[model samples]
Target: MKERVQKALDGIADLVWPRICAVGACSRAVDRPGRHICSGCYSTLPFYAPGGACRICGAPVAAKVSHLFTCETCTAAPPCYERTCSVLAYEGVAEELVKAFKYNRATWLAEDFAELAEGAVRAELDSHSVDVVVPVPLHPNRQRQRGYNQSALVARSLARRLNRRMDESSLVRIRDTPKQSLLGGSERRKNLKGAFSVVRPAFVRGRAILLLDDVTTTGSTLAAAAEPLRAAGAAHIWCATIARAASTS
Candidate 1:
């Protein structure tokens, strides 16, 4: 009865306060509670199973191996990060939303994206024990140009929802590397090689860190960041991204 009354009060508060629409103020009415996105747009967002993904790389897999989402490539050659988790496949509306967030500076849309990312993080929390959330760093030059890092926004949202510590200062990007999307796998690896270094080793030492990024194409950038964390004595590192491009090869 007490819980029911509290829920009613919450509903009343929401009605009075009213959430601002995420798609911008056309002022369309939103029926769903506790969501900034309208019901229509929320339904349009893709959701993939957290299970049945490659444990090591977070790619979609045909079967469940001993490692969560370990596909054939990951089985043959392990990635630098121990594992990865992601919410949506990299295609369709997911790709568009991410692009808008990164390039257009759709800061308001982050609320909706964060909700989705937090759901993914929460699903994996029990299975994979995460001690800290670290956003993949951007080079100071690029970050200055972009004005914001989308990965950091996602990380901050996940951290708030999970009640975990976030270390935006731990990893530093030492060089402004070329975009990984434009390069082939080998070139991507070379582009990001030695690009990241640990700034505060003591904070990460003996801790299980959860690295957050917006997307993973070849995962070379993630591996580059993970290498420094590993050297700094991080006990374990897991990665999570909003999207992953399905490998054609």
Candidate 2:
């Protein structure tokens, strides 16, 4: 009885407040019912292909390799995370939707982003092997200023889809550093140095972790966040993101 009532109420609500497509430019009414993005917009979105990408960093390699190959950059100076998986290239529709979700308070887009990222994540990782999911933490001040941690929202939805435990409190950002977007790759790494701390090491100790983030540029933020997790004795760490910016090198 309650389910029926709730469904009816939701139906009425949708009629009163129709959902427009998530793409900023394409303000079309969503073609798929209950979906955030329209089919047309989603079809044009730039999804990432891992065929010629570096296994460790997900960066595109200039030359195709026969087998799983690490890029020269990753081979020279390895990141803390062993591998990375990302769904979309941070461009066009994907970029607009991410900005909306992160900066404009479109929290409902969390589930949509998670849904898009799930297939890529599952293809690259064994869902059964991931013991816990952890979202890259934002400093308390920043989180408060933003009203919510966008990464945490995505992580929760992803954890639900993966059927893994999510430790939102175990990893914390101790320092409120400058915006990573404004800094270069090397500067981004230095800005976040010693910014993260682990509060409950036991929670992630000896457990495989899937670190979730909204996007990846130089991967400095992900690398910095994983430092504390590695020190806390995490068995292994893999990074996943909704989008990845084009590699500069």
Candidate 3:
């Protein structure tokens, strides 16, 4: 009875102070429990159709070959991770969400992104056979300056939703490379090479790892991060990003 009374009280208080959508006012109320975005705004967000994307790289492929085979790009140069999934396209409102999490340090948005991502990622997560979740590491100095690693924040929520153990400490950014956004494809890959390392091989060895990133543009960052895990003997590495960009570089 006491617990019920507290629940009722909380509900009453919430009614007085309803949760608003994270995006600037169209004044839509957030009704999804533990998420900040409302249905109307969320519907406008550019979500990828999971079924029509490459099973290996999450790139959109011709409808006939989507799940049946690797896309031509992946066939020519396969990424380090075995498979990938993304929740949204990196455009318009979706891009704003990612930028808010990244540059603006809207840490609370991670929860909302994770909630949006779970359904989009569930099939890939299931297919990947992951035993652990790992977030791409940010250089310690950058993390210190930013006050948080947005990738890790998203990964933490994703791990909780998927019931996987999250190992934030296993992956370390050994070198602080410049932002990949400003670089060409080759330059991005070159910059990220040897940037990451595994602090604890024992933790990852023989485990299927799910790597999480907030956004993937050219796949260079994810590939670079996966190499260290591969060397550490992670049996298989799968990746998921909240958004996929149309290659700004």
Candidate achieving higher lDDT, 1 or 2:
2
Candidate 1 lowest-lDDT run of ten? 61-70
Q: Give the TM-score comparing model 3 with the true structure, all chains together.
A: 0.89
Q: How many steric clashes does model 1 contain?
A: 6
Off by over 4 Å in 3: 1-13, 50-52, 62-67
Worst 10 residues of 3 by lDDT: 59-68
- Kindly report which residue pairs in candidate 2 clash with one another: none
Candidate RMSDs in Å, in order, are 4.6, 2.2, 3.0
lDDT of 1 by residue, 78-179 (tens): 877887777777787777778778998876566577788888777774424788899999999999999998899878877877788889999999999887
Model 3, 83-149: lDDT tens digits are: 8888898888888878888999777798888887677678656733778889998999999999899
- Could you say which candidate leads in TM-score? 2
The CA root-mean-square deviation of candidate 3, after full C-alpha superposition on the true structure, stands at 3.0
Best by lDDT: 2
Task: Give Cα distance to truth, residue 63, candidate 2, Å.
Answer: 2.5
Off by over 4 Å in 2: 1-12
Summarize candidate 2's per-residue lDDT along 1-249 as a digit string, tens digits.
975786587577778887788787887877665568888887887998745888888887767666888888899999889999989999877888899999999998887888887787889876679999899998999999999999999898789889888889999999999988888877888899999999999997999999999999988888998989999999999999999997553
lDDT of 1 at 42: 72
